[model samples]
Target chain A: MITVSNLKKEYGTVQALKGISFSIAEGEFYGLLGPNGAGKTTTISIMSTILEPTAGEVNIAGYDLRTNPIECKKTIGVVPQEIALYNDMSAQDNLLFWGSLYGVSKGELIKRIDEILHLFGLHERKNDKVKTYSGGMKRRINIASALLHQPKVLFMDEPTVGIDPQSRNLIFEVVEKLHQSGMTIVYTTHYMEEAERFCNRIGVIDSGQIIAQGTLDELRKSSSIKETIAIAFANLTDELFQKISLAWPEVKRFDQTIHFFTSNSKNDLAKIILNSNELGLDIVNIEIMKVNLETIFLSLTGKQLRD
Target chain B: MFQLAFKDLKLFFTDRRAMLLTFLLPVTLITLFAFAFGGIGKAKNEVKEYDLPVCDLDLTEDSKTAIAALDTDKAVHVVMVTLEQAQEDVKKGNKDCVLIFHKGFADSLLYGSPLPVELQYDEAQEIQVSMLQRALFTTLAMVPYSNRNNAQRMLNKQFDKLIGGGNEQLKAQVHAQSDSLFKSVGKGVEANPKTSSSTKIAIGSDIKMTKLVEAKEENSPGLIQAVAGTAIMMLLFSVAAIGAGLLDEKQEGTLKKLLYSPMHPNNILFGKMITANSISILQLTVMFIYATVAFGLDIFSHVPSLVLMIVVTAYACSSFGVLLASFAKTRQQVQGFSTLIVLVMSCIGGSMIPIFIMPEFMQKIAVVSVNYWSIQGFYDIFWRTLPLTDTTFLTRILVLFVIGSSLNLVALRMFKKNILQIA
Candidate 1:
């Protein structure tokens, strides 16, 4: 449903996106997994037609964003990170206004707003102003506003950034249901768990570049390391880290914990203990991690997903 | 405590809107008011000359003497116009008052017969009328004493009439006494210039003061000014706030969401203009209705003109709000800057102080403000009692339309540049 070709964005001297390309099939729940300030929002904004890329050609639902932006906008709904609601107006009023902007009929819009409000479990507080609602409730209404027109694609940028657990779970379920009902969704987030659970395909982006892109199994197969072994040291020093790096060149240090990826966890764990003893370093704890998106991300980018 | 104070100071200075409100607004207002009130320049002691249109029907020497005295007076600038022109000037608010000397004015003044001078004036110009009346009275009082030629001619004519009917001894005695008295008076006036300047000769000539446009109530001028001035000025302020609704949406993120919709971006700005104009018109209507109920304003009689003026005025004011919003980036900036602008416009535009009272330069500058055109339009309707067909009234509407449409065009460009094009 969406295709981006050599999408690059520059803000003055800073390059936000440096010639990245990706595509998402119809009805696919594609997650743009990245840390904050990694150009995730920029990519989503360009695809959603709210922003123009410095050099790019985005086609959404068979319409070029530059030449046919209105048509592109008609096919996609954007749920911005901010609440994006009128505090002085009721949720129903906000929904009605947004729906009318999309040229939705009043009667049909009323029915859609009713169903979406009920689906989000906010039918009871429809009359109250958005300012009176809690953060999670406002977030739900923020997401609900996008569904009024029933666009072919929904662009959700960090929709669950600052919400309660119950609201997050409800949102997750609603998104899963949307995907099942054949709505293509482009979700951007820093949370690996959300991307792991909901996204059929994922793109790991960092520093204005997409480092990796594939299904979960394909990403795991692409990476050279199959597992990760984490070791905590009580008295870790530059000398000890240097000694460990000499033996295992792929060792990554995060504070006192040294994480090294390998295909064999058992032999590496035994060797790490023996090597620590030989180096006269005290081990505090150790953890053997299986192959997962976090490990694959760590293996690919050499940094934590939440960094 | 020192650190906290320093941090707060830094924060306050960093907030551009707060800095503008704290420093720029007061300074700008003070300068505007000072210049307007003639407190900032050498205009403090400068005198204003009132233009008085005079229509002289009588070509007699006595009438000519009176007109020459008024024309030569430093306080009044006399403009010679026909009777029809004088009446039209006063009625159309071009001239505040007209002085007419009827055919028998010279006969009445010389023989002390019924008075034949009329001072037709617009009742709305009460403030200016008083000043004009002072100049007229002072110049007319000294007309006979100050002009020796006319006075000597009048004495000779009367003496000839008496001699033609009576004895020669009485005529000779009257002529000799009048000649000696005039020679002494002219010598005394030549000796002392202050005597001629301060001489007050009270003549019991009944100068008629006629109100050119009859109003429903005697105090309708002040009432109309209060209603119209407050309505237009306050409507500007309200519309400015309402126009800032666009900035509010931007700050709240709803504007970005709206831009994401299928509608054209210009619709957002046009929508704001329509809403603000509608509210302004409603506000003006409410004010007018209230004036009619509480202050006896005859709004029903001039409904058509009043409605047209109100609409144009509202459109102009609403466009002013949109222009302010288009220039400002945030809601705070719009609020602070608009307050300063609207207040200055109101101060100069005859909303707070009447424009006629301001300095000449300031009055010329007042036309640039939306309040001036709007208030003047209201004055034409309620005070001048002009009909919708009047050219002056139609010009006001056209000027307001031009102002509104011009501002709207500029606002659209700015809105697209500063607002819609940004991410």
Candidate 2:
């Protein structure tokens, strides 16, 4: 439902968004994966019509972003990276206030607020000031506010940033449900797992340009490594890790979350996990996670997803 | 639009700080001003009662005339006493000032020339110096003309009947003979002289000082004009001050959320404009009540047109504040700009002082101030006692609306940034 052609934005001396092109079909969940300042937000701004592109064309639900901004804005919703909300106001008040801005009638707006609040598990906290809410509650409300207009297309920029794991998962579930209900989404984040689980197609952008784009499985099959294992634990000493890694030279600690990369996942993975505990290892969780976009992302970019 | 307007007002009114600033601050200050300066306006009319000392050094008929004359000059309440008694009364603080007549003071009056008399007074009363000095000069200027008849009457009398004829020629000769025979006639009688300058009072005349002061303010409406002008001025500024709350909203993330809604930004501005105008109208109403009720002036006789002008000026201030807010990065910045702009307008517009009394250049500066138009509207309403025709009021309303709308348009343009850029 969204098409962006040769989108480019300039800001004086800085080329904020280099020439880039992408599209998301109806009901598709697309990820514009990139680190901070990687042109993800600049691209989304063009698609959302909050900003104008120096040289490009974006059509949202068949309305051009430049020529028909109000019509284009009418078709989609945007949840920015920042928690843009009134802290002094109650959650329901904030929602109703924004709902009115969208020209939503009072009768319809009251009904819509009820459904949306219940959907986000914020029905009980409706009257409480947003300043008193926890980080996760605020993030959920932030995402829910973007969906107030029930736009056909939704643009979410780092929606899960600074949120707790539980709220992050809840938001992930909500977005999954949205996709199933035929709402096209443009999701941008540095979180590789979010991109892997939710996106129908992924675009890995870096330095204002899209470096790679395709399905996770399609890209993973072409990666240099065949399997990628992410091992998470608390207090696994560096000396112990070094000795275990020395026995298996392919094991490299990737800053807190160690990764085991190999072509033979069935045989090499067992010895790796077994020897990991042999030297004072406190293994909280061990899993042979399937290799997808994150692995391909690390392999192609030579950096962690959260760089 | 109504919903937005109501929402903005609801939020602002619920906020105790905003309410206190917009309503409480101005009202408190106005009350304090009344408490402090209320007496200043009517002080001119309050007659200060003071006892004036009259030292009778002469028991002659001339001394009696001077006493009656002192009574006629209403500025002083004459108290007759001997020289020693008057000095004692003045020393006891029972008298404000003292006038002394040396012995043989009537002889100088008979010559139709200057009289030698003395006026002893306190130095603490600076006000008495000017008033008494003017009363002295006025009394002296008429003395020459007054003494001609007295001198004529005295000279027409027999030589033995020296006191019968009130003539300057006979009294001059009798005074010379009395002086020569005083040592020969008696041993107990003594006349000790002091100064030789003339300072005397005679003949009763009326000068209503109380009436003079009442007519001054009645003719010059500076105090009323200043209060009305300042009220109109600060009323507009109170609207602007409340608009600073919108800037607070912008800084605190409320603007972002509000902007993200489907409503146009203009809708939000319109709502704010209404809230501002409504608050100012309420304040103006209260001040007008104080003017008419407390002070007993018909400050609100032309309420309809006054309210119209207030609404227009309120809109203008509100829009101007928003425009300034768009340029400010913080609440402090907004306050700085508001102070600068409001003070200039108040000064030039004759709010702090009366425009009629101000210099011409300042009045010229007032021509450019919205406060000037608002105050002029008030003058037309209260002072001139004009009617409620739409034509008389529309010029001020139109000027404010045009400037205010233009400012609001500029603010709207500033908010028209790319949504994604905010992220």
Give the candidate number with the greatest lDDT. 1
> On residues A186-250, what C-alpha lDDT tens digit does candidate 1 reach at each position?
99887888989999999999889998999998999998888888889999999889999999987
Recovered fraction of real interface contacts per model = 0.92, 0.36
lDDT of 1 by residue, B337-388 (tens): 8888888889888888877667668888999988888887887887787889
Model 2 compared with the native: what TM-score? 0.63
lDDT by residue (tens digit), candidate 2, B1-423? 999999998999887556656776576546433433333334566433235666667667876776666566555567777777665443322333566655665775664334545565533233443466567556644443344345443333335464665566767777677555544423332232232123333442222221111112221245456556767667656765777777667665556556545565566667776777678767867776776666666643455777776677667767776676566666666665566567656766767655543433445566777777777666555544446663545665687788778887887776444222343
| C-alpha DockQ for predicted model 2 | 0.24
DockQ for each model: 0.77, 0.24
Give TM-score, chain B, model 1. Answer: 0.85
Predicted structure with the largest TM-score when compared to the true one: 1
| Structure candidate 1, residue pairs in collision | none
Q: Report the C-alpha displacement of residue A166, candidate 2, in angstroms.
A: 4.2
